[model samples]
Target: MHLKLIYSKKELYFLKSVFLSKVEHGGASQLCYAKHCKDVLDFSASLNPYPPDISWIPDMKLLLEYPDDSYYNLKKAIANTFGCPPEAVCVGNGSIEVIRTYFYATIEKNDFVRIDPHTFGEYSLSVQLAGGRCTVLDDVDSRVRIICNPNNPTGSILSSSELIEIARSLEESGKLLFIDEAFIDLADERQSMINKGISNVFVSRSLTKSFAVPGLRIGFGVGNPELIEKMEVIRPPWSVNAFAEDFAIKALENLDLLEKSCELIKKEKIWLYEQFERIGINYVPSAANYILLNIGADASLFSKKMLDKNIFVRDCTSFGLPRSIRVAVRTREENLILVEALEKCFQ
Candidate 1:
């Protein structure tokens, strides 16, 4: 009698199906892929319009050597800027990578994770990828809760105090809370919960949004030493390239740049809000560097119409708001052009 034969990880087939599920993120990738990058005004990415100046050219000599797996200096830089010990920092290729590491470290197969709706899709996707189930509602049995602070798409935020309380509540029940503060540097760092020293709470941040260097892909997590150590052990060595490490250290040294960017973004966001009101475009007031608009029409069509004018905005269907679009707060010149394009669309 023949026994059942073992095969490759058949589980990956389900993972593949999960990957095939629809999820869209806005950036210049589409325009670049289509060879229309230069003339296109991209409002899809929510980033600091003005990034602090720094020498981005990496020393070729450094590239000749392998990056330090420990990234001691880089951790020191992050620790100084974020009020965490170097041992409390877990670095990743991007904040998303850090999210994946965290889930892998804590999530068990079939574990239920509580996730908010209409936020960054990555939270749900990452949990599912880690053999966990994601639920939009809070279930008594759920062990983890994910939140995108200064939330994407909606741009809603919870105060540091509000979130600290939630973290404590979860901690008492032997649960964990993960906050994605990727936008906090561009929103209000004073509202960040990174300094709370909550053992069961994890906060992930990225230079992608605040430093406007998505290509560099430097992101990190802050947590108690025990949790950070687990994630660090699971995170692959040399995951951060030489150039990204250098750039991230430089960006941390110039934290004041965030203040300047926030000031300018606030001014521009207000101007955009006024324009939206005057033009009869309904919009949600945002606490971050982006605005959510209610277009009263199919967002995909509105976005395509705007694209015809060489402007790009985020179609909200992927975010589960089919009648809305999200626009990034940009410079005065670009904002004017965007308003002009909108007027033409309405006409």
Candidate 2:
């Protein structure tokens, strides 16, 4: 028997539009690539290719017990790592979840949320889904502003003092400033606003990229105690699993490895840029671990061609860049493979 669902015109239109909307993201879509290619190299996702040595095995006791709903231990670890008071720390399943929860806690219906073009797409989607309107940075009427430091796709970054100035202005006007520092660790930690004691500014940090545990999905936010509490109220209990918290706690213990990885990425990034120069491809200078290359062709087609060579790179069309693609800093051997594959695309 077929059951027909009846809905008003407005409701039906909303449902249809939401269903039809495309969600674009970059990463090793292993299942999608496995069907068409063999021995695929993933340069699409910007993660620490040389991650700290950590065992995947989970403790049996933690596995059996339900995660702490408050995320007390995880929050403490993040606070200590960033030198912030534990009261100001909020842990989540990932930085994206933390961003969404912030919106849920702070954004009112019909409020104006400001975002920069070429930033992460999820910010706009989150605002629209919460019945808030999105505007660009130039819009002075926005009640909230979200900036991705070392922004995705472009890899441009703003200094800590510059961010503080923006935050101060917004605070004076009774507005909120949210900084997405997902890639900041790959750059400079000194530029982070996490432990700055800024009242109106909220900083979201991702453990997935720096810690190389995207599958585990751990992230955290630092802000005013009151704001952190508000987000916690709306966040689902035990959203961060037991294994993820324990894993993150362990990762934090090894700061030396994280530092070593950052130094290596810096060195490799310079080398990658030099390669791009020698190849005569236009590329954006980046402080983060990724670079954007203007391939002077259809980016989607170029990505597919590279995939045919068992190499994967991010198509920048989703970030409103149709002629460019983004690639991550990897080991020298892996990067040589990418360079060879990229050169073929020009042929």
Candidate 3:
């Protein structure tokens, strides 16, 4: 040895893997480059095109004071929204935060988790950071399983019955289940497993996508009271900001409004699919607001060209599909703009 090492080999390897993992997300970063381009359309982030009317102004006077750490009202609102008890709820800055907090609260050294291969990257990173090993391949022996319903970059959804069966099996084995339903509201609320009376399952959901306000960043998790309490302990005090909390609480009060938002997105998705077919583009059948397209070209280059034309789309390389892109279903006019841009790019 030339010299004594300052770090262990295992630590160095783990850090290297973390450094190389893809952490890129859509929507926000692309806005910076689009400032110079007019009429830029960001189709990268999946959000409802017809969010319910929200007209609440934050109390600026309350900015001087800290929010109630207990978040009693917010929890109650979430419980009512999801048909769960308040004691079963845990709130976080966002669904991603709730997910990470759940992993940290439950995972231990040498614990292994299984995750869906074509889903969110945060699940794997969060598991690793929590000192748990994770694998994408199906392993009956894996102690925990994580999945994203209406999965990202693919938009495929499993029915509630399918998920219930899986949860039952996991429970039989004394294993854990974590489900991410961030896109469930935008897809089919009937497919939700939120109130399924399952003890071993924890479900995390977000209002960011459904409310079309990712900037607000409010999300929650529901589980058995014991597990939810554990997550609450790990959740930072006042993780949800005062403004977001207020918006979430009020939004939950009018959950029925999401039905219209869902119906509109479903219709828009069909129209977009027809346009894709007309252009000879291959697309995945999606139940959510976003659809995955097989462009038969380099995803990075295609995404860059689309952005150059004031249209931004999510390149699926981060989701491990290098030749595909994910485009969010927006309003009719906006979707028509996207179709025009697609025709131009392909031709």
Candidate 4:
């Protein structure tokens, strides 16, 4: 008798996915590497440079008693922040969860939608997991459209007018529109679709990225009340940990902190862009917290080179742009290190 080993294609692909997740573990910030260097200015993640209000962690006993089943207060806070009704608000473990729930709620199996090229990969993955189809749209209309405002790698943002026109068209066509505004906090608030009052549109916002509370894993979505109700049905219970909820509540209470952080990012982003220009390296202008750059060729190779020098940046190979890299806007000193290093590399 002969025995044969069996293997499945999905299993094989899963193994690859795990191996090629991100340049760092979910793109960990450079600041965490204090052991390797005295100064770690991580421009890898677009987060609040200012720390949370508390000098230390808060107690979590109250939160452990199981989250508010209805999440009433949480929804109310979100509504207050967005100047909308509580019914128009929905909560999730993170914005990505809300994104997945939204797709699963409406998209029929095998239906196709258009997404930005080399944008966030999770959107496509979520569609596939829901057994739906994805078709890329090239500056053309004719398919359901999803976009990441101030997009992921390049950080390019679609103007409010353009997005409004697109949303109007999609609404008239009876198609779904999902816009991940997780990074839009880095820009002026008026540039967002939320200000335009567009319906049939879902905007997923996260405190994780903006408030540097990623460990809390709390995010919310604002959209049509009917659509949010649909997602709530599919959303799971206790998806948000207790401490995460508390963190969000406290963070939202401090409007001054939010404003200060946003202003700093905008200023630093401009300075960082000028640094890149002065260095004579190739980079795309960004409205978000990070900049996408070209490192000659083979970004993975360039990233490794930086890492060897105790510096790190995001290689865009995962986004299917191997020659480009994305780095967050960090402190002046850290930005200088990156600029000097890249100038050396180019020379």
TM-score of 4: 0.86
- Per lDDT, the best of the predicted structures is 1
lDDT of 2 by residue, 297-337 (tens): 99999999998888889999988899999999999999999
Q: TM-scores of all models?
A: 0.94, 0.93, 0.93, 0.86
Per-model lDDT: 0.88, 0.86, 0.87, 0.76
The positional error of residue 51 in candidate 2, measured at the CA in angstroms, is 1.6
Clashes of 3: 0
Cα misplacement distance, residue 326 of candidate 3 (Å) = 0.4
Structure candidate 1, residue pairs in collision = none
Per-candidate RMSD vs. true structure?
A: 2.6, 2.5, 2.9, 4.4
What lDDT would candidate 2 get against the real structure?
Answer: 0.86
List where candidate 2 sits over 4 angstroms from the true fold: 1-22, 30-34, 54-57
Candidate 4: 10-residue stretch with minimal lDDT:
20-29
Candidate 1 C-alpha lDDT tens digits along 42-117: 9998888987786677778887999999999999999998777999998999998999899989988888999888
**Deviation in angstroms for 208 in model 1?**
1.4
lDDT of 3 by residue, 85-131 (tens): 99999999999899889988987866889987787888888888777
Name the better of 1 and 2 by lDDT.
1
Alpha carbon lDDT at 227, candidate 4: 83
